[model samples]
Structures are given as C-alpha cells and as structure tokens.
Target: MPQSHPASVSSRRILVAVVPPVLAAAAVLATFLSVRDRLPDRMAVHIGGGGHADGFSGQGSFLATALGVLVGDGVLFGALASWIRTNPGVQRVIAVIGGAVAVLTGWLIVAVLLANTDVADASSVTLPGVRAALAFAAAALYAAVGWLVCGKAEEAETVSGPSAGAGRLPLGDFETAGWTRVTGSRVLPVTGALVAATGIVVGFTTGWLPALPLLITGVPMALLTGARVTADRRGITVTPSLAPWPRLNVPLERIAEAGHRTVNPVRDFGGWGYRARPGASGIVLRSGDAISARLTTGSEFVVTVDDAATAAALLNTLADRERRTAAGG
Candidate 1:
C-alpha cells in the first residue's frame, strides 16, 4: 500500500493551489459586473500591435471565457497538487507558479476592461503597453505571497529506508574517488533560441510589452541550457554548466543508493530541465544514461549523463563508508 499525505498536508496543498486562482477568477467576475453597464456591447478583448484591439467580443462572453480560464487553472493545479502525496519542494513550486499565472491572467483581463471603460468606440480602445509590465509584476508579487503561504520543507521528515543496491566502487580505506560528467538536453538550446526569436518577431509586429513574457521565459532557458553532474564525498551535485548557482545538491546523508538507468524524457519526467512527477523528479536532458539516486525523502532525483555507471558506483562506495564511520566501525 502507498502512504497517504497527512490531512493537514493535503489541505494545505489544495488550499495553496486552488484558492488563489479561484479568488482571482472571482475578482475578474466582479470587475466584469462593475463595468458591464459602462463597457460597449462589443468590446475589444484582444490587443495586437500598435495597441490596436483586433478581437472584439460581447461583454458576457468575454467574462465567461476569462472566468472559465481562471477557474480552469485552479482546477487543473488543484488536481495536480492532490496527486503529489509528498515532496513539498515540488508542491511549493507548483503552488507559486499556479498562483502567479492566475494573478497574471486576472490582472491582464482587468486592464483590458479598464482600458475600454467609457469608450464610445470599442475599436478605438488602446491598452497601454505598461499593463503588460504591470501584469508581470503582479504575477511576481503573487509568487512571493504563495511561497510565504506554503509550509516549508520538513527537514525532519524520514522515509522507510533506502533502496538496496550492489554497485559500490572498489575504494580502499582513505582512497578518494570522484566522478564528473557533462550532460544536457539536445533540444533546449534550439527551442529556447527559437522562442526568443519568435518574441523578437512579435515585438516587431506588435509591441515590446506583448513580447515580455516570451522573452522572460526564453532568456532563462537559453542561459541555463546544460548541466554539469558531479559525484564525490559530497554526494551528487547538478548545476547549470554556464552558471555557478541554482544547483541541485543531494548531500551524502540524503542519498540512499545510486544506480544507472535508462530515462525516457517524456515518459518518465514529463519534460526536461528539472521536472517532477508523482513519486519521482529529475533533470532530464535526452533519454539515455542517468544517475538515479534514491533519496532519504522517499523521492528519486535523476540526472542524465554519460558514464553514469561509474558515477553511481562512486556514490554507493561513499555511502557505505559513511555508514561504517557512523557505526564506529
């Protein structure tokens, strides 16, 4: 039988994931109600380049669609949070992302309505470029708030035990061993560049404000394009090859066992670059050799790289030596 998350944990996650989006949806609905009398029957809901309203919709339909999307986000993220029984790290990330997205959507919709208010001609309405920046700011602010709302990771949490494996390196007493390998996704660079290029095209066609989100997403993807995976007495560390910070370090004490496995990026991890599924999470690049580490948190952290077998062996040997030292052997 699988373990169930505590009632409090379940409620916390559900609340964090669903409540913000629901509230944002309610706010959007309220704004629609307050401004419906003033807004034109057919109003501009979509803005294109030069701040021109290209898409027009009835006020009611617009509100319905906006609210539906906001609520849909709440529902989707809520369901995802429920499926995650443990691993607060992933839960917190999800909570912040969901909340931020809801806030962004709500903020943008409100901006649209406000721009059209008291306007005699719906086609003449021009949403200020600043609204895009404002929406991004609101999302960033809500992300911080969401982070504050969720409980921190449980440092004292313990799993049943580590997975037993037989891949220890032949390290003698006082003999040191270390493994280093560079591995990355084949698709990240090209995809990120393409997205950034698209943003540039959109900026030229529309406005810089509309392209902000895409650039924000693509720039980071382009920067943190690859990973350097290393294993030593320090356990395992995976960091961006181009940067020093924002690394994942599973300390020696947290590692249960290490082994190599074949990873299917989409099938196992859903996508690339630090993905999380129910019981597992990984820095998946291409689908090939990966170092799978069973963690004390009862979750697995995988990093795909070449020469993974040797890396796993070194980790197992270090773990055995640590156990012996702790036992006063």
Candidate 2:
C-alpha cells in the first residue's frame, strides 16, 4: 500500500465528516419506517402529513413534530459546523447559541402543533407558561450542546495538529491526579445569584414573602453566595455560595497537572456535572473538562472553571509558589 499524502488525508477527513451524518439520517428514516405501525397514530400522521395548513390528525401532528425536530437538529449541527470551519474559536459560542436555538425550535414546533386545533386538541393537556419555559430550556440545552461539540472537536483537532498538543509544556514535574487541576473559577456565583433572584421573584409574587423584604434580602444573599474562590489547607474549593451547600474541597497534593480537555456534552460525556469515565474523573462543561481530583483516600472533587489552559497554568503557578514558600520557610 502506498502512503497517503497530507492533502489526501484532509480530503479523506472531509469525506468521513460528510458520510456519518448522512448515514445517521438514513438510519433514523429506516427505523421510523420499520416501526411505523408500532408508533402512535398521531405520530404517524404528524410525520406523514400533519403540518399541512389544512390541519392534520392527532397522529399526523405528532409525527410531524418528531420529523421537524430531527430536521431542525440536523440543520443546527450542519450550520454550526459550516460557520466555524474557518474560525474554530467561534465553535463554542456557536454551539451554545445553536443548541439553545435547537431547543427553542423544537419546543416551538411541538407547541404550535399542539396548539393548532386542527391538528389535535392538545390545549387541555398543555399548561400556559410551560410552552415558553420549555422552549427556553430546549434552546438553552441545544445551544449548550452545540457549543460543546464545536469547541471540543476543534480542541481535539488543534491538539492533534502538527504543533499544538506537542511534547507537553515545560511546566516541570508536579503531581496531577493524572488529569488537570483547575483554578481561578469565580463564575459560579452568577448562577447562584440568578437562582436566588428567581426564588425571590417566586416568593414575592406568590406572597410567600413581602416584595420589599425579598428585595432587601436577595441582593445580599446573591452577592455573598456568588463567585468567590475559597481555598484552604485542604485544597482549592469553589461553590455557588448563596444557593445550597457550602464550598466543596479537594486536597492540593492530589491534584494532577491542570490542562484543558474539550468534550461535546451531546456526543461525548452526556450532560454536565461529574461523569464517570473508564478510570478518570472529569467535570463536563460546554467545551471544557476539568480534571477530577481523586485522592488515594477515595474522596474525589471536581472544579468547574471555564478556561482550562489558564486554570492549569494557575494551578502550576500555585504549586510552584507553595513549594518555594516551603523551601524558604
């Protein structure tokens, strides 16, 4: 066999990219057809002929909704990939934004199909605000997934490229839990504040608490609980202070060298939070994975930080500082 030239390799990669998505579409269509009868009548109608302006049968509307969602998702992925081909950095932003859009689009298709009386009298089963909320939630989820896929794929390619992920940086020998230790994560507080504000609104609107009192209380609570790094002799800790639990901590000695890893939530590790891998611990974010610090003692901790490379740099710096201080003292 002859060796493939680099140009041939790039062409092959592009071909590979085009094939899988198309194969996936084919598989979906085949499965739907094979199980068409097993599916609900409304779903069948929806898929077959529900969205015609004339109004479809319940089954038709349902099927139409499903088909619409699949189509929309495909469009979302294709659009994002195309937009970010030349500028990979924009992948994360596009994925998050696109994922959110996908969700919203899915929600709307369902909502509209259900809302249309000609399709089916779905109004009785549907609640008022649920549609908007569902739409927003769906959009948010899809956009997040989009950002994750684009960003991570780009990261992997860049790392695997000729020069990027080369013989790791010269940051010296340090103990990393065979993974990355994240630092300077202070964005979580914003989430806590948002949650707290939502709680306050609900409390006030529902008369569970007076508006004036909640306004007075919520702001301070949000500020306190919002993004702050709390570190101790134990290890670095980060938590949304205002919302629920206190800070979570891990020991410093157990930390692995910090480095960024990108993962697509939709494809790679499922959704967010701590996910178990073969033998490693990692936190799944939009396009980054924070190394899981697992100590020999069996306790494990995950740090949620956006910039993995920067975070790793900070951790290395911290470790260096700690070592210097000890030697000097």
Candidate 3:
C-alpha cells in the first residue's frame, strides 16, 4: 500500500494557507470603510457603498482595487508556501528569495495604494496597530503555508523524479562545513544602489553622519555586485573585480564547506536580504533558495541562487579535488 502525504490528510494545512489573506482582506476593508466617512473636507472622495459614487468611489473600482490588493497578496503568499512545502531540495534555494519578492511586491502595492488615501489614516482607526496586526498576521500565515508546502513538495518530488537536488561528490575526508552557491550579482548592485540612494536622501535630509555609514556599507554592497563564481573544466573561481567597486576572490581550494539553506523570508528569516541569527546566516538570494558557505576564515557568505544544491555540489566537488591533490592522492 502507498503512504498518504500530509498535504493529502491535513485540513489545517489548507486553513493555514487560506486564513491570512482572508483576514487581511477583511482588515483592509474595515479600514477602508472606517476612513471613508472621515474624508478631508476639500478632497472629494466616495465609496460604492450604495452604488451612488463617481469614478473615485465607483462601486466596481473600490471592489476591484480591494480584491486586487488583498486577494493578490493572499494568493502570492499561499502559492509560495505551497511551493516550499512541496519541494525541499529546491527549498535549499527557492524559499527565501521567492518569499521576499512575494512579500515586497505585496507590501509595495499595499503601501503605495493605501498610504495617501484617507482610508489608511482615519483618526477613528488606529492605523498603526492595524498595520502591525497585518504584518504579524501575514507572517503567521506564511509559516503555516511553508510547513504545508514543504511537506507537500517533498512528497510530490519523491514520486516524480531524481530531484535528490544536489549532485554531490564525496570529499576525501576532512571536516566539512555545509555550503551553498548562488547567483544574485544582479540583486547585489540593485540593493547597494538602493541603500546608497537611501543614505544620500536621508543624509541630505538629516546630517552627514547618518549618510556616512552608507559610504562604508555601500562599498561592500557595490563590490558584491561584481563578485561572482563561474565554473569551467578546472574549477570555480571567485571574481569580485568585475564590479565597479572593490573586489575579493577565493579559489575553490580554500573552501572548507558548502550547502544549500532555505531562507523563506516569511518562514525562515521573516524578510529578505542578509539576515543572521544565533548560529546561522542567510541571504535572501531569490524567492526560494540561498547558497550558503562558511570558510576557514570564520566568515560565512550567502548569496541568492536559482538552484542552491547544484551550486553546492559543484563547489564541494571542486574543493574535494583540491584536498585530494594536496594529499598526493
């Protein structure tokens, strides 16, 4: 007899995935209604409450916009969680990066659409608390979704094919530390630029001291944009010089360990891009997986990768060859 997968049996899995967006929609709708009554005297506004509003308050527009915001976000969060639960090896790469993108996209839409509207800031409505609640609730929903999705993905892939993930090669006996490789050189520059731009704006707004940190922080980030690993018959090479900023390099030989780690911003780290905890470090490389590696230098680096396990295996194989060569094997 065949075994039943958790996804097939657990109703909670579905509930966890479904609840957040539903709640979020309800909250936003409540906010919209509460604030609708408090429109600034000069600024004309309307709600389609009775089918008696114009363009700004058209019944269809309000409903459509609300659905777009709430349902869209809910769908994204739910789908990603589903993907993560169903896929683990892929989990090594997809969770964090994917989750962050989904989150940021959702938040960006919500913030931009609602920030200027009276509906977001009515005196009767404690907007901050509501916002906080939404954030917290969204996070909770993500966790439930991740648990269910991870389980489902793992189960589905088993029957599907050779998704063992990384094609790992054995390292000839040396203490190994887990490592993962990723590609987000694209993201590196973009993040650094945003950080730099933010610093510039804030510095000009406040004082130079606040912006000063950007100078230091920006250099490393800009440099990361140039840093990348490329594979050839010989092995992988680190190239940080390609970027316009300062650069760094590490041949495969110096690598002590590598592995793929999932960084679901919602589930694992709660957000995106470079989060560190008590014993682990992660980078939200993309939506799902991150490439993580620790070096003999006592520093661990993570980057976003499409396929973290494959990247790790490649590096591990190269590192092992270097060790064997040194041992005259």
Candidate 4:
C-alpha cells in the first residue's frame, strides 16, 4: 500500500477554490454597474406572496444588497478553504456548493433588477418563470466547471504481491469472490417526490405551462431511487434499484487490477450517485471504504461499500486467474 498523507491545501488548490466565487461576484458587479443608472430611484426589492412587489428601496440600497451578498459569500468560502484545508474532499464539496449558491443568488438579484427596470409601477412587477429556469441553468453550469477544475488525487495503490489465504469463492471452473449491497440516500427520493409534487400542484394551479421547469427537479429525484452493487467472476455490476435497464457492468477482462481505499465521496467524485471524472467513474452511494478497479482501458471505476478489502482481494485474485488461463499456464 502507498503511504497516505494528511490533506493539505496547496497554493494551486487555494487558487482553484477561489476562482468560482470571484467570477460569481464579478458577474453581479458587472450587471449592477451596467443597469445602475437605468433603475428607478426607488426600486421594488421585495416580492409579496401574491407575486407583486411589496417592499421598496432606493437604488443605492439595491446595489448594496448585491455587494453584501458578494462580500459575504467570498468571506464564507475563503474561511471554509482556510479552515478545512486538511480534508480536501470536503473542501471541494463546499467550494462547488458555495459557487452554485453564489451564482444563483447573483442571478436572482440581477433578474429582479432587470425585471423592474423601465416599469411604470415597480410594485406590480412579478418575477418571471424564466428566472427559476436560469437559476437551475447556472447551477448546472457551475457544477460542470467545478468538476473540471477540482484537483485529482494520485492514483490509488493496488495490492499485487500475493494472496496466500485470500479466501476465494468458486464459480464453475473459475474461482470467484464477490459481494452485494444496496447503496444511496433514503432521504433523497422522498425530497425529490415532494418537490415533484409541489411542481405538479403549481403547474395545475397556474396552468400546465408552469410545470415544464419541474422536469429539471423531477428527473434527478427519479434517478436517486438507489442502486444495488454486485461483484463476481463477471466483474462489477451496478444496477439502479428503481430502473434495472440501465445497468453498469465492468467486465473483469477489461480490468488490469483492483484495490481498496478510503474515499471521500465529495472530494473524489464531487458528490455521490454515479459520478464521473475525466478518467474515473464511481458508483459512490456514500463516503468511506470503496473498491477501485483500474481498467486496461486506463479508466478507474469505484464503488463505496463495507468490507471493501475482501472484495478487492477477490477481484485481484480472479483477475490473476483469468490472465493465467488466457496464457494457458
């Protein structure tokens, strides 16, 4: 096994961590500056439940709100980076979630300002559905950027010396070892169902046209129904408990090696549930022990599960047997 180091924030990582928040701040600043002179002297800054502006503030107050959010977010994220430098994975998760929040907040502020501009009555202005759509879009865009920019950990070490008493299971003529477990968040599905239900209700109340944006929230909820993992002679397979048609099967023949490691779901895969990085993909239901298969195709696949060491040992043992059989040794 390769020696593990305590997580430390490198200079490069600090820079990467700050980029998203800074950009989000800049976006708000740019929008405010461009529209500052055009805004009404007393802008409608607050909306009532009836979908009309209920509170008014001077243009300066409106601009101050944007500045306040920017500064507050920057301080919060910077403090998080400095304090949690030791846990790179958790830090990365915070940075990404914070960035998304910053962008969406900025978008909301800017959208409200624009929507009220040149209006005859600020109080009568209602936030359009487009703003909600834009918020979701901004979140998706920042998430992708975060995934691309987040640093990659060094390749996990593999155990290759020998398995003297590795406890191998037999599969017909081939010796095999395997494990199965259910993985995912029990709370996620319920939350998704609730959101979908809310959207449906709102859609029906306001006309079916309002439900289109619900798809964004509904699809992910449906996908979070959980998954079942199985490993054996055929390699590793991840089947979604709700939908079995789209299973992930990694053939043993394609795997060059297998090993176990302690993993952070947020840091390593950005988050949980079938995450994909540049050269790696993981069925990470949660954080902690996991088995990683280094494939001949140069990609790494991981699954979080208990007793990962035994599963990895069996995988490596089976791979060796398959290789020897192929060579007719």
Evaluated at residue 57, the lDDT of candidate 3 is 34
lDDT of 4 by residue, 155-192 (tens): 33232222233344444454445678777765457757
lDDT of 3 at 20: 51
lDDT of each: 0.77, 0.42, 0.48, 0.67
* Residue 96 alpha-carbon offset, candidate 1, angstroms: 1.5
Question: TM-score-based ranking, best first?
Answer: 1, 4, 3, 2
Task: Provide the global lDDT of candidate 2 against the true structure.
Answer: 0.42
**Overall local distance difference test of candidate 3:** 0.48
lDDT for residue 213 in candidate 3, whole number 0-100: 74
What TM-score against the true fold does each predicted structure earn? 0.57, 0.31, 0.39, 0.56
Per-residue lDDT over 1-329 for candidate 2, one digit per residue giving the tens place of the 0 to 100 score: 56545344333333323333344345444554555454433321221122223223454544444555456555655564443443333334444443454444445444543444232332223324555566667666644544433333322322111111211323443533323323332332453465467545433222233234446644554455233333333445655434455545555566533344444433333333444432334444334444334344443344445544444545545555556766884
* TM-score between candidate 3 and the true structure: 0.39
RMSD of each: 7.7, 14.1, 11.6, 8.3
Q: Candidate 1: worst 10 consecutive residues by lDDT?
A: 155-164
Q: Lowest summed lDDT over 10 consecutive residues: which window, candidate 2?
A: 158-167
Candidate 3: segments with Cα more than 4 A from true spot:
1-4, 9-15, 38-67, 88-227, 230-235, 239-325
**Candidate 1 ranges beyond 4 A from true positions:** 1-10, 48-52, 129-133, 156-164, 168-257, 260-272, 275-282, 285-290, 293-329
Q: What does candidate 1's lDDT look like per residue over 93-197, in tens digits?
A: 776777787887788888888988999999998987788788989899878877877766553333222233448789898999888988977677776787698
